[model samples]
Target: MLRTILRREHKNRWERRAALVPESIAQLAAQKIPVAVEPCSIRAFPDEAYKAQGAELHNDLENFQLVLGIKEPPVASIAPQQVHLCFSHTIKGQPYNMGLLQKFIDQRATLIDYEPIVDERGVRTIAFGRFAGIAGAIDSFFVLGQKWLKMGKPTAYARIKQTKDYPSLSEIKSELAQLRVTNDKPLHVLIVGTGNVGKGAKEVCQWLGLPEVAIDEVLAQKAPKSSWFSVASARHLHERIGGGAFDYQEYLQLGKAQYRSIFDRLLGQFELLIQTPYWTDKYPAHLDIARMNENMQALPLVVGDISCDVNGSLKCTKKISTIDEPAYSYFVENDGIQDGIHADGISVMAIDNLPCELPVDASRHFSAILTRYVPELVKMDLNQTLTHSGLGKELQRAVIVYNGTVMPEFTYLQHYLDRHKLTKPSEAS
Candidate 1:
């Protein structure tokens, strides 16, 4: 049997989530698969919990052949011929994680990224997206409350607290259920995307007893009795650049060449905008810098970017906020950011790891899905070609790197690696 270890997450103090939990460890133990866990003080599950499930507590994982983590591991940690499973965050050639990807190549290691582990339909089989949405929605309200209070205008949102402050998701929902918007000025919220993240955000809105209104209704309402929200999909946010109707398939295939964003025009209609969409440079940005500079006054009071892609869809998301400091004010005039809410400019909540705010819940949910794949992952032979490695289509498709070589499907990343090498100080000098 292959030796496996659940590595500790050290990316941030707030990253307390685990790829696997005690319950899954117990299942593996029942099958005679010995599991090792690195001692972590801040992990949602205590070391003793894993120990109870017959997991070995180890500090050094050098002996472990298979390593599992929730995020990208440190560059120094990659060992030759080892298999690593984690959210590598390098699928899109993310510049910040390019070094980490290169480390995997240099060490002759195999990298299986969880982000691309999808079914035949190309939908991700396992992800923290729903939890991200839930925490993001909660924090959005919290930010809105804080921003309003700073501006000397208190609303029902003022009573909401940050997602991390709550002990559990149930408690957060219960508290939100009690909040009542007594002010006559109805709050209109716009949620972008109708995926898992959007559904989770909508769940929070429903807890607040907010009705789902049409975008037309939101635009027509001069004064409303209660707070309401509307959801928008790609069709709602974009249009054909030329004189034609929006075609989703065409936009997906041609991206920016065929479509353009109209999201900026709708910003002023909502007090809050909770964005939860996937974006790449190929697509039109929801709010480009030029549009943002021109329409600063039309910006929403609070933008809860659950997608949290810095400078992705929403250009105002200049940087990713952390759990400790979950918000920043984007100054339109100077194109500067000031930590926390302020009276001037828009308050943006752009925490990249929103799921980490509810670590316990997020871990359990993730572990449940990931446990199904562990048995197969540990049993695979790294020496063989990926096609003959016995991994199912989902896992096979996720193998970005196989023994120092980038998979044929992901050869485009080589361009990014070459670009990084050219830009390196040593090469440039």
Candidate 2:
């Protein structure tokens, strides 16, 4: 029933990056999907403006299908506004759409929760269930990340070391008290990987009440952590006076000696290294990333950069652990080449839900991705299955609505209430 779709303009810096994708790659995306480009905007909404000729939003719904670029929550309630999503609504603040509205509820789903240390199912069962309300959004690839994706930029894992400069016991105690986490020692941590993910990791460390260091700050200084050392970018080495590939030995002998002295001249303070994994089609960054790891055969490291190699693959099983890794990615990935850490290396950690960080700002445009496509989505999803009958009685007993509203069961209603609370009353109202 749908034929043409419009790609929204990239307004945000991140979106701008996503939009400027090279022609070859854009063609590759179009290989199977017959997608056409048009600037999508919510202004297309029927009542949006000076309607001297007040008209229906769609002049021809039959021919053109509006495809929401992003998936938004269902708003079964009235007067939709600001990421509006709902099940049922009240006229006098009382149920207007009942049982019919409840039908849309996706309830009684088992939620997969995990704790590092556990028994029963053992720690292996890190994820295997569902829940009442799980926040879902378009986080697979950030707009800026899309830019980097198209650029095929290099990624690295950054690790910051904690040295004497690290907070003392008193300071650690002071900060821990604020976060409600208690520790005997100052609790040194290493964060690796660079770019956005690394920045996010530093923020998380700060959240966990730990000291951190980034590579940029370290690189600027003469005395980096005495313990671990980072080499140089492989890409940088290529721009020599003559311009020919240098052999490993000659490369080492000729390049900055800082890398060589790293091991032998340990800065006297490092326990870990966080390195990114992404390497561009360009060889320099890749070789640099690999060489750094090859030399430091001792210190522990946490590689946060999930994407590396051609295609920016997320596969990590090749190195270790096959739990397949969770989508924790990055909550707010930023290029944190500064602050947050004490160690000396750029970090690379994956950050998820970048758009949601400021959805209102993003909503300004993401809504375009959604509003334009929603009707088709609605029509397309008309026959698509959504209910989870597998839950059985737990569903019946737990679910309050199925093609209706008012699921009193906590397994259902509680979640709806919680999500509604996330938005301002006027918006969610």
Candidate 3:
């Protein structure tokens, strides 16, 4: 696969939103791989989670090379996907923190290196899913099909066994009803940040019994003036001393000289929110957070800063399910051994060794790209000789709940039988 490289003004901004990433870089350059577009903006690195797509690949770095970008392709400040392959990128290379910028809120996790593919694939395949931190660079290649394949196949890889358990709540309600969100209603969420993604979206909404709502300063100080709303990270819109007159535990230590208008007045009560990558750039104080909520027909939940504002927004054309980073699979890093065949002969590589790369081929390429976005096992018709796609140990079909709901939305809060205001004491008065 010779060259590859591309970005060409992010391929004319996803070809004016018709997106195919320039027909999949002209079918990966017909197949030989020589591709090379580069006007630039394929992001994910050091700290560039869309700094206007790294200032537009820093004024178009020379137009082309051997690139095939989605994340890592920018270089000049020092980026060869960050030298000799840091080989982590399962989805995360930027966003240690953002705008209201909590300065990496404590940042960690970046210690990859197994040693130049440990001599010829001793182990390595990291096909990412869940927390690869901040992912986004997938191409899931194919001139073929993807409308949830049934038509001769473009996606159906398998290997999910070490004992399986993924997408079952009717495969995450048929992948959240293939993300239609035009009007299922229930998506008002607002979480913000502090850690463990606001306790995992309050434990995936008390494990999906759903309903937690919290953006009150008495409803953002009775927002009216013909509400379409605009807190813009509260740079200065003081409605007679603004919402709940400061004291949410003393403004959580007055960080960012006051939570950039308290997370823009708690995301102006919700056009569908959920932040925390420390809230990037801290904004005019809102630099396009959750589609800046003036109500583009509602329905948003830009969680954990992963979908990078719905795939680097110019303004939501739709179709966004980003987690980031994609290269199929490759790694063996941590440059240690190599001069011991005597020095070059013994060669097994890696001193830090994050499990000799390839933990079951990076857990079966993150369980076949997270079971192709978990359509809750589309009612499994398996047994036709079973391939499901690749690396295998299990998944002939297993996932315990995304619909019947269980496995891990925070274990449905130990079956809470609703207590607290169990009344009585007030009746005595």
Candidate 4:
């Protein structure tokens, strides 16, 4: 039997989600797989719940060979030769997590990143993206209400509560269903992307009884009596630098090399912008500081950056907001960031871990999918080479580091490691 332990999340106080729920533990127990759980005071599922499912509550995870967590673990906690599964967040050569990656390499550990765990079609099999979108939209509305109130123009948004304040998703939907926006001034919302995140945001919009309109309708027509939303794809936001027809496939192959953002042209049309697209530095930003400064009067009153990629898609998202302090103002005139909604500048809500606000729901959804793969994950022998290992294609492709060495497919990260000068412990000595 493989020894596995569910580690407690320590990223922030708001991160109370569990990678494995009590039901998952019970399922593992039926298979005679004994599981351990670290005691966490604030976890959505308490220690007693895990204990009831025959899980041993232990502070030390040294005895456990396989450890599972939702987020990246701290560098000081990693042990030598352990098999760890988590969202490493270093695949993109993220400067912040390079030290954590270096620790894993030095310890000769096997790392399985959840971000790349995909099916044959390259679609992610397990993720909290949907919940992120759900909570993001909820919080975005709350921010808008507060922003409008601060600006001395209170609206129906003020009635919406923060996601954490709601007990369940049903309650949130009920509240939204009853909401009535009778303000004479029209409210227009624009959503970006069409993936799970976008769907989640759209679900919230539907609950609020907001009619979905086309981008052309949004740009050409006057704002309707009631609030309405429009969704935009990559083609709608970006165009060829020389003004040719937009070819999405070609744009994907050659990112910023040929594309320039046309999103600014539609800036004056919407009062709120909910961003949910997957973005990187290679893509043109939806709104840059220079463009924002130039079009301050046309800028949206609120920007809900659900995809919270720092300095990535929307350059105004200079930093990740916390659940405790979820809203901030971005002043384009001075390129300054001020906490909370101010009369000047746009109110920005960019919580990186939005799902954390609804821990119970997010954990339940995530654990259900993760439980299906736990058995196969624990059975794999980490001593063997990745090629020889019996892991299925999904798991195999998800391994970013095996036995302290960067996997061949992820060797590009070596360049970042070298640039950061993250030498091994022995090398440093």
> Which digits, one per residue and each the tens of the lDDT, describe model 4 over residues 1-429?
458899999998989999999998998889877779999999989999999988999888777788999999878888888888999899889877888888889999888999999998889999998898889998998898888888898778889999999988989999998886534346788989888899899899888888888886655655464668888888887889888899999999889999988887788888888999888888888788888888889999898999888887788888988899998998888888999878778889999989998899899899989888888888887767887776888999999888899888999998999867755454558
What lDDT score is found at residue 264 in candidate 1? 67
Candidate with the greatest lDDT versus the true structure: 1
For each candidate, the alpha-carbon lDDT, in order, equals 0.87, 0.28, 0.26, 0.87
Better of 1 and 2 by TM-score: 1
State model 2's lDDT. Answer: 0.28
For candidate 3, the lDDT comes to: 0.26
Off by over 4 Å in 1: 182-185, 216-225, 425-429
Residue 403 error for model 2, in Å?
Answer: 40
Order candidates by TM-score, high to low: 1, 4, 2, 3
lDDT of 3 by residue, 195-245 (tens): 433453344333333344333432555543221212121222222134446
Give the number of colliding residue pairs in candidate 1. Answer: 0
> Comparing 1 and 4 by lDDT, which wins?
1
* lDDT string, candidate 2, 91-197, tens digits: 11223232223323333111111111133442221111010000011111111122223345321110111211222224422432354222322222333333344
Question: What TM-score does candidate 4 reach?
Answer: 0.94
**Cα displacement (Å) at residue 406, model 4:** 0.7
Give per-residue CA lDDT, model 1, range 283-385, as digits (tens): 9997877888888777888999988888888878999998989999987787789988897778999999899999999999999998899889989987789
- lDDT, model 3, position 276: 30
